[model samples]
Target: MYRVLPGFHQIQQPNGSYFTVPDRYINLFPFKVDKPFVVQAFDRVMERYVVIKKVVLPDSFLDRQPWKRAQRELFCMLYIQDENVVNMYSAFTPAATREEMTEFYIVREHMQGTMQNLSPPTFGEHRTVKSIFFDICRGVQYLHAMNISHRDLKPENILMTRDGDVKLCDFGHSNMEDPNANTPYIVQRYYRAPEIICETMDNNRTSVDIWSLGCILAELLTGRVLLPGRDHVDQFILMVRFLGNADQLFYSVMNERARNFLNTYREFLENCQPPTDIHSHFPDEVFQGGLSGQPEECRMARDLLFRMLVINPDDRIDILMVLSHPYLAEIWDRNMNPDDIPQPQPPEALRNFFRFQNIFAPETLRDEIFNDLREFGERFNIFTGSKN
Candidate 1:
């Protein structure tokens, strides 16, 4: 059984445990706007907040669950074992009320908004992208120093306070440095490494995280998802198009242990050749490269991005080397203050734009369809009623 306590209007679980912010808060504010909402606890008087979550595991997944309560226990232990990662004041199991039933939750300190919200200088935001990448590198370096792999890293998971400091979050799907391994690879499909799909067959570690970060770096520069795809298969295809396809030698590069693992998936990868001339499929300007910034610096960033988004995750750079990369050093040497960065206005005015369907084009017929769907859902109770 778990314990729960009252803190002002919010609830606290046992030390070191994480519980989802009550649904009331889960779909609130910026978090609500973002899907797969994050949990947070807010204090009105102190102007402080805490992140809390409870991962509800389905009973049917008892045999196939990738991690355990003990793994979560160990995740809490990492905060104690390493300091480079974010600080966790406490982490313990706690009781959560769900209707008439009660269960456990996970809780941790709440970090602030992420770089996704930060607007760079209109004069040239690419420099701001370079500066932000340094902060990301430092945070990632700290995680690697502690031998932890933040496998699910993305802009949303990387929190940036108003003062411009950075903290990496979302360790639920991370890989801890452990000698005895139990599960296969795990990551959000878009950011997932190819080794998980192709060669190692899901044996993931530090290198996989570096690859994900690289993709994130590219996205930050362009304000778009670098390898956006509809689903895992689409993402994999996009990856092959941007980067070359996995070679036959990829499996041979692994050790005997991994090679033995590859035997099971050889036939699958053999037929997994990506479409030829993937780069040619990209928009002409995307390949022609007309963005701002020193061409050399831009090229450097692109080269690093390419290496990280490779078809083979094993070929990607690790945290240590990324930290040592000249691009990072050059960016940091520029001595940028996030506050001083200029923000360019959106191309079109949004004063009259409706909030519910904040899609790019309001005139498009899809907006009308979406507005109708929203109205129907609200009137007919197509979706669940609000928890509050």
Candidate 2:
């Protein structure tokens, strides 16, 4: 969390309507997203402290394809640099196109919150929940080693800083597609993932992000909502009443209109009764309130939440066995492979353009984002962590 400044002496930064570069920075919550008041601002011209994201879009039918959902989250954070990913320094968007109506800010590095408010009464220590689930499973194992598919992992897209550390943030329903193409994809109905609901999901959609990181570590070890589904058929009836009926070749790629709604959820799980295991719905006070009264970290967090709450994405549990799960082997780091990590360089074809019916203005979106931060800052390595 890089602070240590009172610099930029006389102060300025808050003048608004963005990127003709006025606002010297300072709005701190006037609540803005579509109404556009403040997503937050504070630079005073690089005196530090950032974060002011936006990729606004509206006119909807099925999809205008909001510039391919803002180029699958700025090309998956411009090709996945890690330290648990989330950086983006600058991408002002005073321009407009793709059938007009645009606004796309991007200035990141600002945290100390979210993991959905670190579960219950603002979760503080308790041995930093295995180093914040080993920095969110090493940021989803560096986005499945770049094959990418963060189809929305939950816990409000995990962020945390006041020295806690976790990162992965909103890859607007990320891609590299095919997680068994059934279509209607948009996670977060209790972290969806029954092959994103039997459109017969096939393409190992990164095991539907390991079943939404085991429902975000079972809602940070029981701050509740391990499967609090309210839609998508009550999130497949609370995941078939807690990981129960799933294999008939997992609905043989469901397409008889979702295999007749998976045979009426297998006749409503054969008249509801036997279906609870995952330590009988985390009984012992949800592992004595998030790994506290430790019984070997609640028996390795109930065997890593039954191998990450699998209803079957080919029997989930991946992020490298969740970074060697022994309840997160104390933030393990077996030199995280993938050619010694830190990626993010291949992107240049018109800076990976995704036909948003070309329009642009603010001086061509500030000369194609400062020529993509000067050709990806002279090639790769832009991590911005240790608090950018």
Candidate 3:
């Protein structure tokens, strides 16, 4: 066993490289007690700063399964290779054998900070805001194209580099778009999509991600959460108030529980006023000084927001469409030309592992993750290209 130190600890990886991390955690969220211990670390081999996420393994099978998320996150990091997405260097257990492992560690590129620390975008920095939003869209688009959905897409999950580039991180809540998986409470409250709120998300998983992007973009423009709902009930009510009552098509897809909830607030629904346009939230003056110094930019931004924040998932704009929108035209041309982007094939082994069987048991997931780690070590390396 590695010696525990008060000041710092050196964690040796399977590949002989090691990371030196401080004893104290760099991040600890009060709301999520089960969150992994995140600390800043120095890579001895790479000679660069890195973030090490330490996940404690539960001793008993009866306990909650944190490894499930860790397994999915590890798979996603390995599968995706994008500049806009955070790069995970490696994942491994400290113990020599899988049965002896007590902790799982994921080593990734160190980011300066999350978007939460940044100041709100002002009118003078409209183009900069657009660029940031463009980066986010590119990340989301790449994930969607790879058949993954980052269910949580709030500012906190968006990390900023020292050079001001934004990259998506925290894949605990991310997964492949499975229509059978109906998780209404997957996303954070403020950025949650209406379809997710109403439990009407049939096969439209990626669109919920687009809704979150819309909320994030709105926050970037105004410096506040677009929909600050106190609770689930209030969140749905806020959506109704902002986008007006759901259409017949929206109601048609909603399950029995959602229908019952709507009936509970039938009186309030009847009394709610007509929904306001996106312009009312972000007026022309907001985009006067920046955004090409034209009012048309405001219209385009609003138009994009309107389409993105659509109440109906079917009517919502896809990631590709969002990338193609006029507001992000310049960034799209410069960085994200369709021909230049490379499409990666999703791992068939992982896909079959998730789809073929009931892998909910902790033991099953643990074994799968062990196999994945072994395969990853053999086939892939950061310094060199894939062996296969």
Candidate 4:
């Protein structure tokens, strides 16, 4: 049984152990709207800490966007299980009935801090950065192989454990890889890909994720955001300035709106020439404390970044290629068997749910979510809703 205390929530397991979660959270930002409230919990059975993410469901029936995003996040987490990905313990609603359910809860393994929040000294060593980046690549590679794209991959979404293990989190913006999927407004502006801004994504939805990874890598090395665009136009202009003008092939693929924008700012873009030396952006002092400052390692890192941050999506390095890159060679296991790799199999129920276009109705979505919860409860031998 699960019950709420005056200032805390308690969840009882069938094994006679319990989990206690306080009402307050460590990462609460009152000014930030729409952010989920995450609180740490103590699991008596495991004798370890966990995180409980509280998601408030919209009251209005007409608003189903948030509900859909939450459902998508849950399904994505269930679909992919990897060492570099955050692990979900369980999920439930405390409300006895669907009508009374105003909030949903997701319990997951505890992480020390996010890449964005951790101090620079934590990543002062170059090998540490490489290892973290390598883990991220592995996670992305697994997702891509499963035909999923993590639309939002930023420092804030990269979680780090106390043991220095890196895991990817926040799948609210994730979706199955579809070339024609028109959601250019997905990733954060700073890490967004050029093709996404141009709205020219086609047959390569994963490329956007790669672009985001490049931005994250740059941030890890320099201790700041690489492309800090104030707005959509600024982001595109900055990208052009760094990578030079878009090629004929790239221009040919651009939509009319993007083309118009380019023509409007053609003069300004021409003045912002590409840098002669990309290495200047990453200084030796940043990696000098560790062996990562070696000339050979620095060259490999720069070369990898160059390939990843290409102006054209078609020219960008794919996730698999990134895993095989020489920079990540130390972590790549040569003796690993192909059969040992875990393949993602999206649930049949989820596939069917997505097939219905008109299922966005609030009532319909609520029912589907409840059904999913019921199924999860059965598999995990946990209580999700009242039997009565």
Which candidate gets the maximum lDDT versus the true structure?
3
| Residue-level lDDT tens digits of model 3 in 1-388 | 5544344456554434444444332332221223326666555555566776766666766743366666777777766677898888876654546786666666678887778776344546567778889888888877677566888898878989756789998777676677777766777899988878888855348888989999988777766687899998899898878777777788788888888878888888767654465667667654434553666767778898888988878888788778777777776555354445545455565565445434578887777677777677566542232221
lDDT of 2 by residue, 1-388 (tens): 1121221112222445432222455654433233352255567656776666656544353443454556456555655566777776665333333233344455677775667764445344345666787778777776566555677777767887766777988775665544444445677678777777666756346778887788777667667677776677777777767666777777786667877866756777755543456555565566434355666676677777778777767777667776666565555444243344444443443233422213443444434444553455345323221213
Candidate with the greatest TM-score versus the true structure = 3
Q: Candidate 2, overall lDDT?
A: 0.59
> What residue pairs are clashing in model 4?
none
How do all models score by TM-score?
0.61, 0.34, 0.81, 0.80
Ranked by TM-score, the better of candidates 1 and 4 is 4
Task: Name the regions of candidate 2 deviating beyond 4 angstroms.
Answer: 1-42, 45-47, 52-62, 65-103, 106-109, 112-126, 130-151, 154-157, 165-168, 174-194, 201-210, 215-246, 256-295, 298-300, 312-388
Over 1-388, each residue of candidate 4 has an lDDT whose tens digit, in order, gives: 4346454555443334344443332332221123426656555545566776766667878777677777777666555567888888776665556676666666678788877766355454567777889888877876676566788898878888666788988887766666556667877899998888887755237888989999988777667688899998899988987878777688777788888878888787767766678777555555434545476777777888888998888898888677667777666644233344445554565455444523577876676666766576567633332111
**Each candidate's clash count:** 23, 8, 0, 0
> Listing every candidate in turn, what is its Cα RMSD in Å to the true structure after a full C-alpha superposition?
16.3, 17.9, 5.8, 6.3
Off by over 4 Å in 4: 1-36, 61-64, 119-125, 271-292, 333-362, 381-388
Give the least accurate 10-residue stretch of model 4, judged by summed lDDT. 25-34
TM-score, candidate 2, is: 0.34
Candidates ranked, most accurate by TM-score first = 3, 4, 1, 2
**Runs in model 3 with CA error above 4 Å?**
1-36, 58-66, 119-123, 201-204, 273-277, 285-294, 334-361, 375-388
lDDT of each: 0.49, 0.59, 0.70, 0.69
Q: Itemize residue pairs with steric clashes in candidate 2.
A: 13-23, 13-24, 13-25, 14-24, 14-25, 180-201, 180-202, 180-203
